[model samples]
Target: MTVTSAASEPGDRRGAFLLLGAIILVWGINWPVMKVGLGSIPPFWFGGLRLLLGSISLFLVAAFRGRLTLPALADWPVVATVGLVQMAGFLALVNIALLHVPAGRSAVLCYTTPLWVAPGAALFLGETLSRRKLAGLALGLAGLLILFEPGSFDWSNRPLLLGNAFLLGAALLWALTILHIRGHRWHGSALDLAPWQQLTGALPLLAVAFLVEGGPDAIDWKWSTLLVLAYNGPIASGFAYWAAVAVTRRLPALTSSLAFLAVPVMGLTASAVALGEHPQPALLLGFLLILIGLVLVEYKPRKPAA
Candidate 1:
């Protein structure tokens, strides 16, 4: 299955970095947003509604831009697979984990996506593990370890263990999607299929919600709930997903994976501010390590000979 992005050629680093920053900012805040939504919405229905609204938002934007179209016959399977794993599987897992885990802790575990992506990129995409990238990977993992605070986590507690495992599954599934997207040969730009993939992913969830969770009526409608859902659907999941796909095509897979380390840091920070969760000093140190890791991962050396 071939995944395609908006640009066939490599993208401008400056623009990609700018998109990265925006993705982190919006998605980082989404932790609190999801937490807020879960307050008035059942987890499965909330996840399904988010994808439904997100699909609508993307389709509208693509139509307005005259870029909306169905995926090619050859692309449908890839689209369905990604929709299932990346959207339905990952989100459902994370939502369930969030019910038992703190937003910050869950974010940390999910951001371990890089650990999974790096090896897959090397094996499947044939991306090299450059010295700087290796250093960055090490630094990022170290930072995550510090932030994870394993000694403090109650591994003995069944709920915490289950929540953490759910998050880990989310991370692995997300990594598989990233690897697939990175290797996909283009039949259409990622943006062109965004709505379709989102909708495809939502269908299963919607069915499950109707059968298991009793459908959208299960949602407790409130101003705050509607506001966050709107933000998530249009801005965070819709725009951010497009931007990420475009940027991922431009950057090395390893670099993209390492950069993901920033999201959890931002999520942690936003959760602290919005949810009144106190931050530990390790959080600050983790931020520094991630920045350094990003720098290392992104740095490119000039070729010595042709």
Candidate 2:
């Protein structure tokens, strides 16, 4: 569990909360950062390069802690699942969607993964589907409906529609990744395996970048552009990933879920501040509905007669 002692023993509950807060901040702001990066590079290249730097940063972290090692043979499947689906596919698609979608709104759409994950968990993980969960699902879908309401969304706008589709797809992919991670018995701590997964995810992405964007020539290389790119790597992806895993290993699940929900909220706020994105009334209402649903979903009722 060297996630490196994972350093995440229960005694460090305060530390875990601190890390969770950091994760929310970094990941939330990251939405606008990715959107900004797209201005300087094509989506695929932007995603690939950012991911590559993140992987390298992770590798360095593992090495510096003397915890660096190849993934355990048994861990490779989970690594590939996480790397390809969550790290590579989900992120790549999200970046592409940012090319068309506004950052704040896209943040709302992309975070719908938990709504999908609840049902999938019940079916696949043999978890109980409680009444609260059902209610949560209903409310979450209501939110989605509001966002997609005819009066609000211009479905006639193809690029916007496509961008929303991509974000939803990314959410689904992330849910699938989490389901797989849940089903798989772990042979290594998340920290130990994470760097390898990053590399596994990054290599194919760079290949795609090569074929699609054709080289480094397209990158803007401006100061603001490079600054965000650097931020995406070490701070957002690397440290955030590490901190999240460590916090997950330490904190109560419900606490983690409730805390993590701040990500989209922060994303919306950051988008407004950084990208000048003002939320429409419908979008804001939809966002509120989704947050309430998530709170319900993470609420665990008592076990009957246990």
Candidate 3:
């Protein structure tokens, strides 16, 4: 019985790890997939559709599990904030940015979330900003400078800059969201919050997509585009979001951040192999520094107990 229990523990952990890996793979590939999808639909429309589908799927799952709960009237404001930040602010900008910047380049820029989170956490949550984290932030910012050189600036490329800016803004918003969720008086598992947030947040986007993109008729349908859309909606947004919330409960925040290190690298590598985009040397160096900074930020030293 002892041996069986020990073996089962490892198996369980491995399953969790595999699930996390799958989430990263799907999300990493999603960068290029969004680029492909955007060719056939406008950014707001695509975001609206994806979130609509995701909301439906998540609601169905919640219903099936008997876990669906409507958001309280007071929580509407928080839901709206998350919706605007994650769906409208982040996805809309990223979708449009893909037209101007390579998918790989944009992915690198977006995953700079940890850099922003380190300081935000310190300021908002009273989390300590250790020397190591400060050093990491410096290194990561240096890398960003290399990636976004002065020569790369051009008004004609406004969309790309806008996208990068939106992603950075989204990261800050996400950090705030994290702070909000942790402190808010919600009465459910994180899984329960997922569908409510997606559905609630998608309302404005739905309206905008319909008004701007001529409803569903605007989409120039293609199998490739549809496949990407489905993947992002159901698998990436629906399942992956739940999985991440589940895993974070079992792992420390630092450990979770370490796990996500794989995401940006995989995103860039997959973009190169699948999309035939080549990253510049400076860009490569920038990613290296970002990775190093992430490690520094997440590394924790043991403290003496009172």
Best by lDDT: 2
136-205 in candidate 3: lDDT tens per residue?
A: 9999898887877767667467766777776667666666665665456654455666776777657777
Please count the clashing residue pairs in each candidate, in the order shown: 3, 0, 0
The runs of at least 3 residues in candidate 2 whose Cα sits more than 4 Å from the true structure, single-residue gaps closed, are 1-8, 302-306
Clash pairs, candidate 2, are: none
| lDDT to native, each model | 0.78, 0.83, 0.74
Give me the displacement of residue 141 in model 3, in angstroms. Answer: 0.7
Candidate maximizing TM-score: 2
lDDT of 2 by residue, 157-249 (tens): 998888889999999998888888878878877878877887788888888988988888878889988898889877887888888878877
lDDT, model 1, position 225? 88
The RMSD (Cα, Å) of candidate 3 is 5.4
Q: How much lDDT does candidate 2 score?
A: 0.83
lDDT of 1 by residue, 1-306 (tens): 112323334659889889989988988899988987888887778778888888999899998998888899878867887889988998899998888887876777776665666667888999997777788879977876776578886778898788878998997898898788777665866778889988988888888888987856788888998898899787887888878877778776556655656788889889999999887778667656755765676566667996
Better candidate number, 2 or 3, judged by lDDT:
2
